[model samples]
Structure formats: C-alpha cells, structure tokens
Target: MSSLSRRKFLLTAGATAVGTAILHGCTSGGNAPQTPASPSTNASPAAGGEAPEVTKAKLGFIALTDAAPLIVAKEKGLFAKYGMTEVEVLKQASWPVTRDNLELGSGGGGIDGAHILTPMPYLMSLGTITKTKKPLPMYILARLNTQGQGISVANVYKELKVALDSKPLKEAFAKAKAGGKELKVAMTFPGGTHDLWMRYWLAAGGIVPGKDVSVIPVPPPQMVANMKVGNMESFCVGEPWNAQLVNQKLGYSALITGQLWKNHPEKAFGMRKDWVDQNPKAAQALLKAVLEAQQWCDDPANKEEMVKIISDRQYLKVPPKDILGRLQGKVDFGDGRTIDDPDLAMKFWRDNASYPYKSHDLWFLTEDIRWGYLPASTDTKKIIDEVNREDLWKQAAQAIGVPVEQIPTSSSRGVETFFDGVKFDPENPKAYLDSLKIKTIKA
Candidate 1:
C-alpha cells in the first residue's frame, strides 16, 4: 500500500533520533474513580462469545470532563455488565504521569488502558513519544468525546475583542515582550491534541511560536494554577478546567475548539496492543461496556448526572456548576460572548463519533511530522496500522449489538476543512503539510 512506501521513506531518512528526543516529554487525557468495589458478576463475557482471558483490569485517566465515558462506565457498573468487573478508573496527576504509568504496564505499576489523545497510540507504537524502546503498542477502541476544548487567555485579552482573530493576540504578545515580559502559552503536552490546537491557533495569528512567544507543556490540572501564578498568558486544554478558568475569573475563553474545527476527534478509549493480543475477548468486553457508556454520556437527560458523577471529589473535583454549563451546551465566553450552542457541545456517541477512523490517525501522524515531534520522513501508514485498532473496535461493536449499518462503511472521513479554511486531505497528507504557511520541519 502507499502507506508502506511512506514507511520505507521515513526509515530511509534517518528520523530515529528525532523520535527519541520527544519520549522524555508528551501529554494526553483521562479521569476519576469511585471507592473500590468488585463489580457484581451478573453479565458474563463467556456466555455466548469467546471468553475473556482476564476480567480485572486497571485503567488510568485525567480530570478533564471528556473522560466522562470511562468514569461513568466504572461508576455506573457498566464495566461489570460486560464482565470487566475489576476495572478501576484511577485519576492521574498529568498526561506525563499517565504515560509513565502506562509504560510501567498493567500489574507492573502502570495501567492497561486509558482515555487519551488519539495520536498518542500511534506515536507510542513508533517509539516516537514514549519512555521505552519497547514501543508499547496501543489500540483505539473508541473515541471518548469531541470538541469541548478551548483556548483561554488571561483577563487582559478582553480588550482585544477576539474570536479566531489572533492578530490582536499577536499585537498583545508583542506589547508584552516590549515591556520586558516574555509571553508563554501552555498546553497539556507536547505532540498531543492540545499542543496541536495551541500551535495551530498561534500560527494562524502570525505568531512565530518559539520566536514570538514560548509554548510550554503544563499538566492538565495544573493549567489554571499556572495561569493564576502568571506562569502563562493563555492555555489550551479540555474542560471543566477551561470553564473553571472563566468561573474563577482567571481568564476568558478566546475560542472553543469546536469553532476551530467542528466535531473534531478528541480523547480516545485506548488499551495496550499486547493486552488485546493476549486477551481478545477481554478487550471486546471492555469496548462493549465503554461504548454503552458513551451512549449514556451523550444523552441530554444523563448529562446532568454525568456532570455530578465526574464532579465528585475523586473524579473531576470541580464544582458541578462549572461542568454543568458546558455539558448542556451553554458557552459563557467570560468575554461577553454567550451562546446556547447544543450543536457544538461535547459528544460521546451519535454522529459516528466513536469510530477510530484511519484517516484521523493519519491526520495526527501528519501533524507529528509537520512539527519537530516526529521526523519529516516518518512512516505514517505503517505506524497507523500498528496503532489503530479499528478491526478490534468493529468486533466489540458487533458483539455489543451496534447494528452492522452503524459501523462505518469507510474509515476515511475524506478531506476536512479547518476554521482557517485549510484543507486536510487524508489521501495527500504531504500536500496538506506543504500547504501550511508555517511549520517546524528541518531540511
């Protein structure tokens, strides 16, 4: 396939070292846990299908609200319904911590699965962004949610009257530098979703990233604190942190990511590749429960309960008010922009949101190569095959009773248009990269 050709080219181009330098740092997503309780052994994975090799598993997550499906599945006993009764949803301090914990591997001080950046599994398999040379192979079982993230600037940004207009941001950044202050913007991790969002936004505004302003990596939970302490002028992250920033009066929402790109893929339901290989039945069981939970999260009636569930001291630890507004499609920009936009809110299921499209993974791979995170000659298609678990997701979806018709006929979503009018064609990733006016590729 053409993917193989690209893979051969990447290896031929000597990009191994570039991938190594990135392993020491990176970022992704996840959420909370309830008090440990063995799931009731009611539903059985072995009833009519292949029996799972293992039933108990530990998964990791962050505080972001997009992690709702995982948290809900665990809290509501959905995992037990599929016989993954021992599943425990542990809260992670940051994305780096999540990666490190995953590297430890299941039962070895790490987790077996996670809710994470869609690109992360691909990067991990290629050894482009991990702490191990072993290259943990990860599977994208389903998407957790999409498009509830935002870029928030400190209160001073209110003067700019901005929404996708970064020129004002650039002018403010220049002014800050002229006053002897270096402007720093933070994202959850390097080479992850937030990083891409922040980079795209900054570049669109004519800011030369590292030159005009510094882009720093901060943990998800630490974003607000970092901003409060003047560590950064703005940050791109998932909610309810973004919403919390507005509630605390620390910053104003400059733009919602959904506005940046409608229905964009966000966090994913991911597990170790070996885990799937050794315990295929168990993996399907996990997907079955999580998929059900995704449907539950997408329900308008369940959103309020989901907000309250994740708002627990153990889950998101934020007030329900902070999370409830956005959960119901209420956007308070904190800059005098408020819109009841249910159309643009977060989605866990519906609209073919959970399918792990090979095209989207390719897009992220292209972005990795576009930036310095991966080598320009990186083999995207080969790594995409190694990381994306669409085949497995199909199996789980079928086993869970998702109609054959609901399964996408094609994995590619075709060429997508960005808010800036940039087009990303999965069939021609190189051209898409070349079309970009700003990039970090090295000759």
Candidate 2:
C-alpha cells in the first residue's frame, strides 16, 4: 500500500490543522450517549448461502434522504427485478456507529453494504478506527450522490444582519478581521469531508477556519437543533440536515458544495473486503440493483416519488418537502431565497462523479497527513493506490451495465481550484501545499 509523502503530508496537515483541532476540541464535551446495539442476531459470517440464488439482501443507512437510491431500489422493486428478494433496509444511528456495526457484522447492520461518505470505507479498510477490534476489508461499489452539502447560518446571525456572500460565506470571519465579535461554525468530523469542505470554502473566501472564525464539531443529526439554540453561527453539512433547517424555517443555505466543486463525489456503496471477495456475484447483483435505481432517480418524473420513499420513518425520517428540497435541487433558504437548479446537485450519472478516482482518494489522504493523522513524510502515491479499490469498483459497475468509461482510472489528475486560486494536483501535492498562504505547522 502506498503511503502519504512526508512533505505533502505536512502541507496538507498544516492547512487543515484548525479543522482537526475543532473536531477533537468540540467532541470533547461528550456527545449524546449512543444507543448500544445488541450483537448480531443473524448467523455468523460462515452462514451465508452458497452461490447467489437469493437475490434480495438487507442494507443499512441513517434516515438521510440521499439514501434515495437505496430506498428507490427497494420501493420500485428494482432489487426484485434483479433477482433480489427480501431487500431489508435498516436505519443507522450516526456515521461512526454505522461504520462500527458494519465492521463488527452485527445488529440492525446485517448489510451486504451501505450508503457511506466517500472517505469512510477507505478509513475502515486502513484500520484508522481508534477502537475497532480488527480492520475489515472495505470497497466502494459505486458513487451514490454528489454536492448536496451546504453552509447554513443561525437565525440569530441573520437577525444580527451578518453578511453571507459568494466570497467568504462565514460572517464571523469578517467580524474578527475587523476586530468585531467572534462567531462560530459547526461541522461533523475533523479529518472527514465535511470539515475539509467547510474549511476549504471558508479559506477560499479569505477566512481562516481556525483564526478568523470559531468552528465546532456537532453530529450531523444534531446540526439543526444546535443552530436553533444559537450554539453555532453557521454550519456546513450534507442533506437532509440543511434542508431540515429550511423546512423548519430556521436557517438558509449560503453555499452548496456543488458550487464549491461541481459534480463532486459525496456518498458511496461500500462493503467489507471479505464480503466482496467471498460474494463477488452477490456484490455485482446488488450494484446492478443500485445502478438501475440511480438511473430511475435521475429521471425528473421519479424525483417527487423518490423523495417520499426516502423520507419515510425507515429512511431520513424528515418531511418529504425537506428531503426533496435539496434532492430535487430546489433550494429554500428560509430567509426568502429559493431556486431550481437540478444539476447544481447530482444523484447519479456516467460522469466521474459516480466513479471513485485515485486522485480523489489521494486528496483525502493528503488531508489526513495535513491534519497530523499520519506522519508528514509518508508515501502519498502508495496510500492512494491502497485506499482506492478501483478494480473492485470497476467489476461491480460493469456487472451493472454501466459503461467502462464511467469507472475511475489511475491517471494522475490535476488539482482542483477553489474560487480563490488554490490548486491541488494529485501528482504534485507538495507544491500545492507549499503554495497556500494559510498557517502551517509540523505534523
């Protein structure tokens, strides 16, 4: 497995230090106690049937509406049409819990796989989990959705007349720069995409994530409640959390991730490595079910119904309106801002958005190094190769009838540019990291 290069790692980690500090700092207050899950009631790993005769399987997800394809796959009987039977979908508690149960192979977690953030399966496979007994094999079968994340400010900030704009969406940053009162923003995790995206957006607009504004980590499900009480001035998170705020008429979207990076990868279908190795056919069949579901979801006619199914108590558990608000790319800022831009956020398609590229995986690893999660001098290329299960993703996509071009390639891709002019090249991360004007420190 390739590791992150020390030089590049230092650069990335330096840029992201503030975000990671916020993650570790904020969660230290202790979060809502997690509901313990009973051990697996299902048979052991050895109990799965031989061959792939039973087409149906159970999948687990937190009731976020973006699990739309999974919901649609079952609701439309697409899984059944593909020879899947008894396609049971279970809701999970949170990202960490979702990851743990999947790794442990227990509880409402009797899944062949699940809808996960792009970085999760990679982290689990790498044994990055602090207390996991043993690392399990993990692979992303296909990308599910992209660019549904947003930055939302609290009603108090709106009442206080804070400015949110195309540049520097954080109102607190400008206040601090001019020596005004400090404001706060919240995110889910330190090294995760939510934190990275939030930091990237703020930094691009000339706001320093750590110095210019105060950022905290609040679990995704708790974002709206936190903002309502003014625990935070603004937040950056994925749907339907942002949409939930709008539906409650409490907050509004200042920036959508798509505006940050069009057709970016956000979520994916991931399974344990051993599960994939042992049940390649089962994996392929399930991918077929989801790919078909993806096609259906992309259709405008099916979106309303798709929103309703995913919004059920078994899924996101939010109102269909909130679920559909962002899913359909129909924004409701609640402060009197609304628009319809379907392509602004994507569900599925043939673009690289659905394929997990090597560079994309490398980018996250770069972040891991930057935030001091790994040694600053690790081999970046080696780690990128190991984390990206491209071969497995390809096999699954082809089995589902997706075109080969839709699968990722190993070609070193150019770094993405924020509206502010920072560039990230998968091939030359060190130079990219060195170019940043942000504060840097040793990992």
Candidate 3:
C-alpha cells in the first residue's frame, strides 16, 4: 500500500492509534528548594498535646515518577513537618504487591497504606480483584496526579516512519498482521487503571486487547528491558518507565493517556478504611503532607531538581535524563519526531482534580465489565458506590484545608470526543466497545 494511503486508512478506521503535563519547578527560598506547604487547615496540629505523632507507619509505592509526591514528602521533610516522622516509604515491585502489602499489611510488617491506581481501592471493596474477603476497607486521602500514563512503541516500528497518530498506530498493526509476527504489548496490571486505559485506547484503535494483539503483564521496572529484547513492541505504564524508553532510544510514546482523557485520575493516597476512621487526625495529617508535596512537585521551578531527586537509587533508579525527558514534556518517538508540551500528566490538587467522583470510578468499572473481568450485565453503580470512598476523601480534604467540590450530581455517560474525534463514554460500554471495528469479548 502507498504510504499516504496507509496513513489515511489508519486514521479513517480510527485505528491510527495511539498515544502529561509539563510538571513545573518551584523555587524554595531561591536555593533550598521549596517543599510542599502543608494545607493550612484545622487538620494541622499545634505545638502541644504530644504533637499527635505517628510513632511508626509504613507506606507502599511502586517506583514511578508520579510516586514523587510521596518521595518528596519524605525526602524534603514534608512528612516530618506534619509530625509523620519515622515514615517508611517502601518501594514495591508491582501494583498487586503494593495492593496486597497494604491489604494484608505484609511488607516487612506490612504498611499502613499505599499510593495506588485509583481503581484499586474500589476493586478491593468487592473482595474479588485480590486476596482477602476481609475487605480491609480503604479511602482516597488525596489525588496525587491526573495525568502521566502513556503508551509507547519500539523504535523498530517508528523506523518504518510510523506516525504516532491513531491511523498510523493501526497501520503498524496491519503491517504486523501481514508479517505474521505477533505484536507484544505490556501493561503493569490487570483490572486496574493502567489496564483499563491501555485496553480502551487499543479498542478505540481497532485492536482487541487479547485477540488482535498479545497483551501481557510486565512489571513497570521490566517494561523497558522487555521491549529492548523484542519481548514486547509497546507498553502502557506510568511515568519514568516511558521516560526510560525515550532515554534509551528504544521506543517513542505512541500516545499519552492524559491526551485521551484530560485530567484523568491516575493515582491516589489510600489508607485502610479502619485506619482513616480510627486515626482521623492522623489521616488528615498524612493528607496534609502529601498535598503539600503535590503542590511542591507541581511547581515549575523544582522540575530540574526533581529530576535529580527522583533519580536516587531508592526511587526510580533510572538516569535523570530519561526521567527528565517526559517529566519536562520533551518526548522523542525515535523516528525523527519529537514534541514538547506533550500535554502534562498533572497532579491535580483541589477542584475537580482531587475529588474522587463516582463517575470516574464508575467509568473504570464499566471498562472492567467491557474487558470480561466482570460480567457484562454488572450493576456498575452499585459497585461504584461500594468502592468509591467519597466520604473518607471528603473528610480528609476538609481536614487538610483542601476545598471539596460537590460530586458530579448527574451521571455523565455518553460518547466523549477525544483527540481527533475519538469518542469514549461509560453509558454504553458495549457500544463503545463495539464501535471500534476491532475485536472484543463479552465480559
């Protein structure tokens, strides 16, 4: 096929798929680096009353750049500022381990909580997604970021002069089909946010997750290595990993999830529901520290320094350059294409960013149903209400002086027009599933 024809066909078929915010740096004292300021609210404990110190608490995190808020909180003294000294932020290998560690309190005595994909707590609520029916009960302390998940493809595909557009994405797949070589793509976990985001983007591009393409679970740390060895062609994962690919010149980001859905929920601070209930003050204090960290990390002045801090062996352990590539919105697809302002994967604070809206939670559940993880006729609303920890989230926000907006009072279910007219909606997950002219399975 002519190159022009191939491009047009990919775009026309809506398969030309595929693919954060530029995090701003902050200047603290002009040289010392500004750490996040604790929200000045009632949750702030005074100098007296034993300071309400948390004697010892463990927190779990997977090593992604979005985990920076927590890392910075600990490294920059935000946690200590809030009396959460003796805080141990354990680096986990994968999302499931992170979730299990929090649920069972299993990481070297386990952890008090975790920074997790938004849907984990909800999925945990049903007691089906993971181990333990005890329902360790959880709450979203605050949203860490709204942007920063992306899809990436190997340099070999881009060497074919592949465009990162939807049409180009599909054409690359068609080429794969004609070549009779299986295309392997990776996601960090199944039934969580990354899986859903990757699945939806692939479905929208006319590729079925299981049938049209080979989808596998590879932990975030191994994604780049797996791609380098040709074990996978593309991957959908959180930051630093994608940045790792760019730095290694192995792959280019085919698309970013944030572009597909503006300000989408990516990660949140989660605590055992019981923990939040019993230590309401402590929960608020924890949220205060994290919120401050978020704001501090969001500042443009700190971006360069953040690159240095996150590159620490204890955190992402990647070169600062790779982490800086995507963090600064400088993306190279390795095919003689690069774009700045690649749309930042923002860590949204208050407003709609911080609120754990039922609509957002329901949308993920709908995807779970679409992908056969849940039965097709599942009661999405029931599952959403049971999983969405709005009550706890609101209390934490209020305690931290963060503003609480009213939850979206009405259901927003319909076709959502995304980049170049790609539509996504939860109302008719099936229709959304079916419209792509791609392969799909009944959930």
Compared with the true structure, all predictions reach lDDT values of: 0.76, 0.62, 0.64
**Maximum-TM-score candidate:** 1
Candidate 2 C-alpha lDDT tens digits along 197-289: 777766666677677676666667777776666556688888889888877878877767777776566777777766667666666667766
| Candidate 1: tens digits of C-alpha lDDT, residues 1-443 | 11222111111101121111111111111111111122233666678866667878888899999999899889888877877878989987777777777777776978998988777776677665676555777777888887899999988778888778677888888888999996888887777888889889888878877889988777777777767767778889999988999999998998899889887889998888878788888888888888878877887777788888999999889899999898778999998899898768987776667777777777776776777778877767667666777787788777766766567666676767789999877777778889988889854
lDDT of 3 by residue, 118-199 (tens): 7777667656555655445666666677777788888777755533354456777778778998776778777777777777
Model 3 stretches astray by more than 4 angstroms: 1-54, 106-108, 132-136, 160-180, 348-352, 403-416, 420-443
* Local lDDT at 351 for model 2: 44
- What shift in Å separates residue 248 of candidate 1 from its native position after superposition? 1.0
Off-target runs (Cα >4 Å) in candidate 1 are 1-44
Name the weakest run of 10 consecutive residues (lDDT summed) in model 3: 12-21
Q: How many backbone clashes does candidate 3 have?
A: 33
Better of 1 and 3 by lDDT: 1
TM-score of each: 0.89, 0.78, 0.80
Error of 1 at 125 (Å): 1.3
